[model samples]
Target: MTEPYHIDTSSNWRRQAVEDWLFGLDHLSPGMREKVVTAWVSAWASSSHERLEDMPFSPGENPYRLMDHVNDVTRAGLDLGARAAADWKVEFDPEVLVPILILHDVDKPLIYGREGNAGVHAQLFHELPHGVIGGMLLKELGFAHTIVSTVATHATNAPFHGRNLEAHVLHYADLFAADHAFRQMGKTPLYLRHGR
Candidate 1:
């Protein structure tokens, strides 16, 4: 059976969130897998943010929580990677891709401010950006170089992207997820939405 790429949150979304992340990390070797799990838990515990719902889908949109955005991207990326391999004969390292998927947008809370329930990116981010911030944070937490590189470059259309196939996959995957979030919001008129 094929694993799902998208999650529709139930009442127990938090436990389901853990399961979703673990699914992405399942491709890693045992040691690295343990390390990722440890860091993920540590980051969540140590983070100043209270809940994923506080973070917006983007600096401009809040159709969903930051958690929703990351989960969507991870699922999309994994599915895209699989299709790329089977349909096009292009292959990427799943070990490399999974960590990148998990960490790619994890810095939304750190790089943006919580004004109520929305993520408003700081002025610094217009220059330095979340990909850079997220990369630095993950590296300090003791991630490998490839994962760092991939996370740091995964921003859509950022300069560091397109440097390699892994980066390309991540960049496009982010776009796909962001588009998904925006479309969800698009169901209602923008004026009716809370965020402008």
Candidate 2:
């Protein structure tokens, strides 16, 4: 049997810091949670950003922090998923949903740089979309196909929007987070913008 991938978060300040944002996912299995945290910490370790909070939601002068958006998406997903389950009697697994939400933007750290120079490395070494990179990482780390595929297709611009319940919930949750952030910043929401 293959050994589970593990990282000693206690020894590294960076891993602990990243784990803070991932605290509320007890709904996920320990192995899945470890993989999710592992992905985030690994991305941070590979990137130029000194901290998880240093990564931005987008590449430009955007004010949204990547983790903030991720947390927002997760919360919104839970709320929406609950409502859908209660109202429409649809079934979805939180185990699948939560990890995908947490790791959906796992590539942000790698794709972006420090505050002043974000996306510089992206223009060169990281050309893939954040979703694609994240999906690739999760796959390399042995995540389930459902989780990996959902993370891969969760991007708004992804060619194949997934057909599963978790994918649908994640898609709207991500949109909800970004829309709220953009509106709060007094810019037009991405869904409302043209030439996307």
Candidate 3:
């Protein structure tokens, strides 16, 4: 685990940030906490770019790439989940939700070039079982089994065996963000333009 990626436990900012995030997840069981944090950090460590500007995905004209989309979706998921938790009076740890949000798309980078269209990329990556890979990554990082299972099962749709309320929230949030981004990119009709 340490060989492929190094955990910067020395950085106060990173350490503090992680702690704060974990604190939010205090509602979860100890095992869940370990799994979520491990998965979250593993995804971040792998997807982090050298420059912020290098985050977005551009077909050709743009300088960024699809990895940026992954980051954006993750953030959107966190925001949406927080709002939902507040509105529903559900006592959830933002830490738990946040990590799940972040790691939901851990395999996007690996599938980008291989699939040209967004839908195809998603389908192809879905085939690769990113959730399983993410779970393994979480385990490697010392997360608890519960969290690892949660992260791995986040993207799975219902009736097939993988669906949790928290994970579902994160998944919907990602979809919302991606739809918004598609509209922004002029690939779809903007909500306002639809005359709804």
Write down the TM-score for model 2: 0.87
Please write out the lDDT profile of model 3 over residues 62-149, one tens digit for every residue. Answer: 3334545555666666667678778987755655565666556554433332222222232334455656666666667665455567
Q: Tell me the lDDT of candidate 3.
A: 0.52
| lDDT for predicted candidate 1 compared with the true structure | 0.65
lDDT of model number 2: 0.76
Better of 1 and 3 by lDDT: 1
Best-to-worst ranking by lDDT: 2, 1, 3
For lDDT, candidate 1 versus 2, the one ahead is 2
How well is each residue in 105-169 modelled by candidate 2, as lDDT tens digits? 88777666655743344542345765777777788888889999989888877888789888988
lDDT of 3 at 107: 45
For this target, which candidate reaches the highest lDDT against the unseen true structure? Answer: 2
lDDT of 3 at 64: 33
Q: Pick the candidate with the highest TM-score.
A: 2
Model 2 residue 173 lDDT score:
89
As a whole number from 0 to 100, the lDDT of residue 37 in candidate 1 is 57
For candidate 1, lDDT tens digit of each residue in 21-123?
A: 4546667787666555554444443344565456566665465777777778888889888888898898888777888887787566555656765568654
The global C-alpha lDDT for each of the candidates, from Candidate 1 onward, is 0.65, 0.76, 0.52
Q: What range of 10 consecutive residues in model 1 has the weakest lDDT sum?
A: 1-10
